[model samples]
Target: MLMEKVAEILREASAEAVEPRFRALASGEVMEKAPGEVVTVADREAEAIISRRLRELLPVPVVGEEAVSADPALARALLSEPAAWLVDPVDGTSNFVAGHPDFAVMASLVRAGRTVAAWIWQPTTGTAYAAELGAGAWRNDSPLSRAGAGGDPEKWRGVLKTRFLDPATQHRLQTGARVFGEVTPGRSAAGMEYPMITDDELDFILYWRTLPWDHSPGGLLVTEAGGVCARLDGTPYQPEPPGGPDGLLVAADPATWERVRGALA
Candidate 1:
């Protein structure tokens, strides 16, 4: 029920605020947040809408990507809350900014640093994904198969956000990437790529960044679907802000994660 309402919030907010602005920005609809990051009218307006609805759903604190970017202190403060909701108003903003169909709206509930529930909605195609703690993940209403249940991992197909990597690593990985399975990076959108893990399209995934809003939802979905999630060092991943222990490794299973780690290590 909570997830259904969460999905409803994402769907309605996207339609109302995000979709309308897709490739339709006004004079001041988009602005740069950082050198490479951005915030759009769609992102701010959609987060406002979702923040209101999610607060209505539960009285706990709401930590949105845009809101936290404006208020730096919120990031450190959220980790201490008993419960909080993480919202990514318009993930894949660069893609959305470019009119690519990869942006998504996401929400996740974290109780004392543990992700209890998550929802990722792609408004462009009306497709959605949901998962709750200890329960199976679903696409719409159908149950998703556990990892490796769909197909073989020949060469071990996975997602690696190579663009965000160091120049040397990026060049090495992208140029001679034939050795590594040509994974489709999320392009700053976990909601778009995480669903692929559930369907077993991706055998594993590797991400070096530790942004909470980006990983919280997708990580929960992968584990709920019977996959493995951890950092490169084989430690458990806790949902939190950046500036701490980073790196993420989610795979079809523990063995696959280890194999990939060993190969890359």
Candidate 2:
């Protein structure tokens, strides 16, 4: 029932605050929160709706991307708290601003530094992805699972976000990844990428920044779907209350993760 409730909250936020503003945002409604990072009025409004609803559900700290952007201390509180809600009101603000259909509203319930439940709602398609820590992962009414072996390291296809990496590190990764089948900078949305992994559309994604709102939900979804999500150093991906420790690698399975990690290393 809690999962269903969170899913409803995502849908409500999208309906009440997101969809109406898509492609219709005024000049002032979209602005950069930081260099190369954008946020929209929909991001704020939808976050408000989701955060309020989440507090009513558990009275826990509501750590949203916009909220933390406004107050960075909340991120530390999220790490210290016994539980909290992590939200990305609009996962692909740039896409949404440009009238693209890939934006999503995502949220995750974290307990003791681990994600316990998560939801990602694609407003355009009205599709929802949900996962519980040990239960499983689902796309709408269909169960999601890893179905096949990732055959060859050289044949693996994936996304590696290298924009945030330093020049030296970026060059190393780009040059080292030459052996992979096909590599591209992803669509800039973890919400979409996680689903693609579960659905077998991609073999892996290695991200250099591990922001809680950007990854917590997707991490759980990938793992629950029988995939693997870990840091570049092979530790399980854990949300840093203050947010750092780069390099998150998520793949279709453990073998693929190792193969991909080696190719890039």
Residue-level lDDT of model 1, residues 213-254, one tens digit each, is 888898988888888889888877778876777678888877
Tell me each candidate's TM-score: 0.92, 0.97
lDDT tens readout by residue for model 2, 1-265: 9999999999998999999988788878889999988988899999999999999998999999999998999998567899989999999888998898888899999999899999999988888999999999999968898864458767778898998788999889988888888889998788888888998888899898888998999999999999989988899987776457888999998888888888788
Best by TM-score: 2
Choose the strongest candidate by lDDT: 2
Q: At residue 117, what lDDT does model 1 achieve?
A: 92
lDDT of each: 0.82, 0.89
